[model samples]
Target: MELALIRHGQTDWNLDERVQGRTDIPLNETGREQARTAAELIRADGADWDLILSSPLQRARETAEIIAEATAVPFGGVVDGLIEQNFGEGEGMVVAEFYDRWPNRDFPGGEHDDELGARGVRTLDEIVGAHPSGTRVLAVSHGSLIRGTIARLMRTPYKQVPRLDNTSISLFAHDEDWRVVTIGGVSVAEAIPTTV
Candidate 1:
């Protein structure tokens, strides 16, 4: 199975640098355009996806819908496990201030890193298991979730994972095990080691 994980497009919150967490923010005009650009990139990449899936959040769902429409790919319903991490009290705070207030990156009552990582991996397994071998799937999700999932798959610390840009894609392939193919359009060999 091959999977392409995409981060949702920009939102007002994203531009304001607010901690979106579980907040359901809609995409801005630029965000919609970004989705279109992402679709074009995927089309140019020449890898057809069997279906597109996304988190239930508005930003991710809308991005998926736009991509599906642009690419004529099937739209699979949202996966609950693909939802963004619950930032608890950090939601809506500016990222810089949030870090100043919580230097350890722990928000009061926020979803823990381990929990998010486990959920991300489980979601990946479920998606892969439900699809036939060689099927290509695209999933639209949040930055933290994407990064955490990749970090866990590579057996690296979450902090070591690079931040993903809006609408960026990370590709993975699974045979006996999952392996990183590319990240943010960069080949795995150029971005990071294929295996830790």
Candidate 2:
């Protein structure tokens, strides 16, 4: 199985550096353009995608729609357990301020790290098992969820996994063992720091 994990495009919350966990924020205009560019890149690569799945969030769904339209890949139904981690009262808080205030934990009622890891792993493993052998899939998800999923798959700390940019593709290849071909659509050997 060859899985392409894409982060959803930018939103107003992203531009404002707000914590958008579980907030149904829509994509900004620039986000649509970014999605189009990402779709073009995938098309140029000649990826023969068998499925295109996305988080149910409006932003991720829209981005997936754009990719599906651009690549002519049939968009798959929304997969459960791929939503962003809930931040509770921190949803609209500025990221920096939220971190400063919490220092150690998320907002009250927010999800825990263990829960993040379990959900990410269970959902992805289910995806891998449910799809046919040698399936080539594209899954559009949130930044934190993608990061948590990657960390769980690699058996590393979530913070150790490099952050992915908006519309960036992370390839997960499953052979006898599952491994990552790329972290953000580029060889993991070459690193870049980017934000949505």
Candidate 3:
């Protein structure tokens, strides 16, 4: 299966730099526009996704819905394990504040990196197991989860993880082994690139 993992569009919380973990915040106007632009790029690229999976969070759901409309594919089921890493007491706090509270990046009463990484890897692995090979799938998820999952799948250390942009598409193919086709590929309003 070829999986396209996308981070949700921008939310008010995102603009405000607040930690949004399972907060269900809706996307801002700019975010909606971003999704639409991404959708157009996907269409232009001729990326025909057979499945459109998403996290239950409103941000991810809305972005996935837009992509489904643009790609002309049915929106697939929401997977629980795809949800963002819990921020716990860090929710609504500034990004800097989170670091200040927990220098090691763990939110109080929230999930740790190892567990989050495992969840991300497990969720995609389950999907891959349930589906046949060569299935084109798009999954709308969060930044941290996407990064963690990709890192886990690649077996890379924390320092090697790359930051993902909103609506940025990362492609990975799982035949016998997982191969990263691209990472942090953006969708522009102009002509879409043929390759990811």
Candidate 4:
């Protein structure tokens, strides 16, 4: 099995550096181009994709649609499990401002960072397990979820995983064992950092 994990293209919140957890924002223009370019790169590499799984969010779905259109691949619509981690009341606020509001307090009800990481791992496990042998899945999701999934798969600390760029592709191949091909494409590799 092979998984192509892609982060959604840039959104307005991304450009503004706002906390966009659970927000259904659409992709910006640059994000569309990035998705297209990513699809082109995949096609150039001649990768045979067997399935397309995308987050329910508009941004990720939109990006996935574009990629599917470009590659002429059919998509398995909106899997809620692949959605971004919920930030509760911090949804739209700037990260710094959100921290200012919370100050020295922490959110309750398994709302901590660790809880989110665990949920992400569980979701990823379910998604990955659903595929059969030799199945290739293209998953379009948010940066945090993708990072969490990568960390879980690689057996690294969640906090240690590198930030994923918009529309970046992280490949994981499974046969007897799992392998992370390139964190992102060669060009994106230079622009972004990888955990391992």
The best candidate in terms of TM-score: 1
Ranking under lDDT, best-scoring first? Answer: 1, 2, 3, 4
Q: What is the per-residue lDDT of model 2 for residues 55-173, given as tens digits with 9 covering 90 to 100?
A: 88999999999999999999987987778888877789998898898876556878866678778777777789888898898988988887777777766677767777899988888
lDDT to native, each model:
0.89, 0.84, 0.82, 0.76
- Superposition error at 5 for model 4 (Å): 1.0
Model 1: per-residue lDDT, tens digit, 52-128?
A: 99999999999999999999999998998899989899999999999899987777888977788888989989998
Candidate 2: 10-residue stretch with minimal lDDT: 187-196
Candidate 3 lDDT tens digits, 94-144: 988887888778667888778888998888888898777778899999998
Candidate 3 residue 121 Cα shift, in angstroms, is: 1.0
**Best-fitting candidate, measured by lDDT?**
1
* RMSD of each predicted structure: 1.6, 3.3, 4.9, 3.4
> Model 1 clash pairs?
none
Q: List clash counts for every candidate, in order.
A: 0, 0, 0, 0
* Backbone-clash count (model 1): 0
Candidate with better TM-score, 2 vs 4: 2
RMSD of 1: 1.6
Which scores higher on lDDT, 1 or 2? 1
